[model samples]
Target: MAEFMTETEQSSPVVPHPGTTGERRGRAGGSDAGPYDGQEAAALLERTRTLVDPELRAALESLPGSLRRIALYHFGWQHADGTPARDNAGKAIRPALVLAAAAALGGPTAQAAAVRAAVAIELVHNFTLLHDDVMDRDTSRRHRPTVWSVFGDADAILAGDALQALALRLLAEDPHPASAPAAARLADCVVELCAGQHADTDMERRAPDEVTLDEVLAMSEAKTGALLGCACALGALYAGAGDEDVAALDGFGRQAGLAFQLIDDVIGIWGDPRHTGKPAGADLASRKKSLPVVAALSSGAPAAAELAALYAEPYVSGDAEGVVRTALAVERAGGRDWAQTEAADRMARAVQELSRAVPAPEAADGLLALAEFVTRRTG
Candidate 1:
C-alpha cells in the first residue's frame, strides 16, 4: 500500500483556484461563501440539475402519494424558507459522473432514458444516505436537520425503501434492453452497501485495538465503492457501450469511489465546518473508524495511544472537545498525510482507467477532468 501511494502521488497536483488568492481565514470563513459560487464545479452542478430534474420529477410522480410528498421534501422541492422553489437539493456529483461517462461512450445527452438512469442512481445514493443518517444517529445533513430528524425515523426509513423501489422501477421501465441488466447490477450494489454498513457497525462495537487498516479499506470499498461502480456501469450500458467499456468504467468508478471516501475521511477530521456542513472532527465525536484513524492505530504511534484512550471512555457531556483533540493527534501523527496520499493514488488510478476505457481524446478529456474535480473540490 505504501508503494502504491508513492507511485501515484505525483500523477496529479492540487492547483489552487485563481479566485482563492491564498488568503487564509478563520474556521468559519471557508463555508461562509454560498453553496453555488460561480466556479467550474458549481457550473457542472447546475448542468447536472438541468439534466436530472425532469427525470427526478417523473419518477416522483410515479410514486404513491405519501411517498411522493416525502421524496419531494427530501429533495428540497419545498424551500427551506417554506416556499415552493427547487433549491439545490443535493450536489448530484454521481449523476454528473454517469452523464459524463455516457457522453464519453458516444451517447447523446438528450437520451431521455439514459438521463432517467442517471436520476435513478442519484435517488438511490440519497436513499442510502437517508437511511444511513437514521442508523448512524446523525441529526444534521447539508446544514439542515436530516430527513430522519425532520420527519421521524420510521418515515425516513419508508422514504428510503420507496426510493430504492423507484430506482429499480425506473430502470425496469426503460425501453432499452440493457436496462434490465443495469438494474440487476444496481441491486447487487445495494446488497454490497448493506454489507458494508453492517461491517462498519460491527467495527464500532469492537475494541479500538482490534481494528486494522486492511479491514477499514475493505469496509470503505464496500460502503462507498460499489454504488460508484454501479453509476459508471449503468451509464455505459445506457450508452450502448461494449462490455469492455462497461468493465473499464466499472473499474474507474471503484477507484474514484475509494478516492472520494478518503477525501471524505480527511474532511471528517479537519474540514471547515461551513463548507462541510458539519463540525470539525465530526467523525471522531461519532467514534467512526474512518480510514485515517485506522491508519494511525495500525501504525502504532503516540497519536494512536491518545486515540485509544479517547475511545476507551464512555460517552459523556463535554467530550466533543476531547474528541477533536484526539483527531488532531491523529493528524499530527501523519495519518492525515497517509490518507491524502492514498486519495491521490486512487484518483490517479481512476484517471488511468477512464483513459483506457475511452480512446476518443475529447470525450476522455471531459471524463478525466470530472474525475480530477471530484477529488480536488474543497466543498
Candidate 2:
C-alpha cells in the first residue's frame, strides 16, 4: 500500500509501517510496542473537548460584542451572523495532547485537574490560527470563509489578540500551582510563534535557493513545535512531574509536531480538495517555500533547476499544468521522499522521548496514537 493513503481510509496510525524509517528505528523501542488502540486517540480527543468546552465557551463569552462575535465565529460555535451553529472547533489535538500527557503520567486525577490548562492551550492554538489565516491571506478554514475574509483583517487580528489574552487570563485565575508556570510557558510560546511567523513571511520574499533546510526546520520548530512542547510540558507540570520528566514530554511533543508539519506540507501540495477544502496546488500557487520545496531546491539534481525556474516565476491563476509540472519537479528532485523519511525519523525520536517519560506502551498509547494520527493523515 502507498504511504499516502486516501483521507477517508481507516488507518492504523499507532504502528509504523513495515520498512519505514520509524520501523527501522524501532519507533518506541521493543517494550513500547504493545496493543495500541487507534480509536482511543479519537475518544480522548472527543473527551477532551467535552471537558474543556464549557470553560472555553465561558471565556469566549466574556469577550465584548465585536471581539466575541469574531472569536465565536472563528471557533465554529456561531455563524457569521452571530446565531448558534453546530460546534466546529478543530480536532482539539493540542488539548488532547495536554490531557493525554497528564493521564499517561498521573492517571485520571491529573487528567481531570488539567482541564483548564487544556482549554488554555486550545485557546492559544486558535489564536494563532486566526492570526495565521490573516497573515497568509487564506480565504477558507474548516470549509468556511476565514475570519479575515468574513470580517475585515483588523477585526480578525483583534480577535486573535483577544484570544491570547484570554488564554493567559484562564491560567492566571486558576489556583493550581501549575497554572503560573503554564501561563509563563504559553506566553513564551506565543512570542516564538510570532517570531516564526515573521521568519516565514521573510523567507517568502527571498530567493528559494537562499533558504536552507536548517533554517526552515528551525522556523517549523518555533512556529509549530514550541506550542506542542509547551502543551505536553504543562500537562506534566499539572501532574506534579519533576523538571526532567516534563522536559522529556516536551521533547516528545516537539518531535511529533515536526512530523505533523512534514505531512501537512506534503498534503498542501497534493492533498484532495474534497478533504482539505482548498484548491489543488494552493501552496504552489502561493509559491510557499515549504519544507519539501526547500529540500528540493537544496538538492543538486537536475530537477532542482527546473523547480527553481518554476518557483522563480509567479504562478499565473488557473495554471493547472504548471502546478503539475512543479509538483513533479519537487518529486524528481527527491523532496517528497526526503520529507516522508524525515517525518518517520522524527516519529522515531518522538517515541524515544515519550518512552523516557512513560515507559509503558499501554500508558503512552494515547499520545502515540495522537502523534501518529497527526502525521499519518494525508489531508
Candidate 3:
C-alpha cells in the first residue's frame, strides 16, 4: 500500500547529497553496532525462515490442488522451472522488524509465536502484491512473470485470497494468551489497508487538480503505515510489553513507514531498471499520483503546470517521451527535494520514538539498525 519512489528517479542528475554521512551515522549512533548491511537483512530472513517455514509449509500443504502449488510458487518456495531452489525469497524485512520489537521488549516467552506473527505479516504483504499486480496489470515480479501474467487473472486473485486467509489462520494459531488481541489488531490493520486502497483508487479516477497533499499523506498512512504499526504493536503484544512500550513502538513504526514510502516514491521515479525491476518512468506512464508528483503539483511550479497538462491527456494518447518529460518536470519543480527532506524528518521522528521505547540493548540495536537499513536502502 505504501508508494515507493519511481526507480527511474534514482538515475536523475539532481545529485545533491541529501545528508552528510556523519549526520546519518549520528542519527543511528545511539545503538550498539549491529549488522546494517544487506547481508544482515539476509541473516534476518534466514532466522525467520527457520522459525516459520514449517508452519508455512503445513499451511500450504493443507490447501487443495493447484491452489496450494501456486501459493508455493508465489512464495518462491518452489521454482518456476519446478526445480528445488531455495533462493532469497523476499527480504523478510517486516518479520525482522516484528522480531526485533519483541526481543527489545525483554525476551518474550512466546518468541516462536511472535515469529509466526511476523510470517503472517509478510504473507499479508505478499498477498497484497499479488493482487496489486493484477489490478495494476503488471507483467512481472521478483524477475519472473507475475501470477496473473502466467497463471491468468483468476488464479492470481484466488491465490491472493488464499494467502490472506492463511495469514489470519496463522495469527489465530499464536500460542500465547495475548494472541487474540494481536489477531484483532491485525484484522483492524487489514481494514485500514482497504480504506487506503479505496482512497488511492479514488484519487486515480479524479482530476489531478482534485487531489491534495493532505489526502496523499492520509492515504499513505492508512495503506502503508497501518500494517507496519500493526507489526510493531503485535510484536510488543506477544512479548507482554507494557502499554507505554507498545505505544512507543507503534509511533516508531508509523514514522518508519512514512519514511519508507517517501524513499520508495523517489525510487519509483529515478531507480535503475536493473536494480528495481521496473521500467523507467513507470509511474508517469501509469499516471500515478505519487508523493513527489503530488507535491510538485501542489507547489504550483511552472513544470507542475506542464505535468498536470500531460496527466490530463488520455493514457492511450500519452507517449513514453511525455512520461519522461513529466517526471523531469516534477524534479525541476522541487518535488524531489521536498520528498527527501520529508523522508529525513520521518526518520528522525522514528529514532525519537525508538529512544522513548527503552528496549533492551541488543534488541534496541537491531531495531535501530533495521530502521536505518530501511531508510538507506537503494533497491
TM-score, one value per model: 0.83, 0.91, 0.84
- Tens digits of per-residue lDDT, candidate 3, 44-144, equal 65786677677667877788978876787787777655556575356666777788788777565546558778878887887888887887777867666
Arrange candidates, best TM-score first. 2, 3, 1
Per candidate, the number of residue pairs that clash is 0, 0, 24
Best by lDDT: 2
* lDDT of predicted model 1: 0.72
TM-score of 2: 0.91
Candidate that scores best on TM-score: 2
lDDT of 1 by residue, 170-233 (tens): 8888878778888888898899989988888788889877888998899888888887878888
* Cα-based lDDT at residue 311, candidate 3: 80
Return the TM-score for candidate 3, rounded to 2 decimals. 0.84
Candidate 2 residue lDDT tens string, 241-327? 999999999999999888878877877787667665446688888898999999999999999999999999999988999999999
Q: Where does the lowest 10-residue lDDT sum fall in candidate 2?
A: 1-10
Could you list the CA RMSD of all candidates, in the order they appear? 7.0, 4.5, 5.0
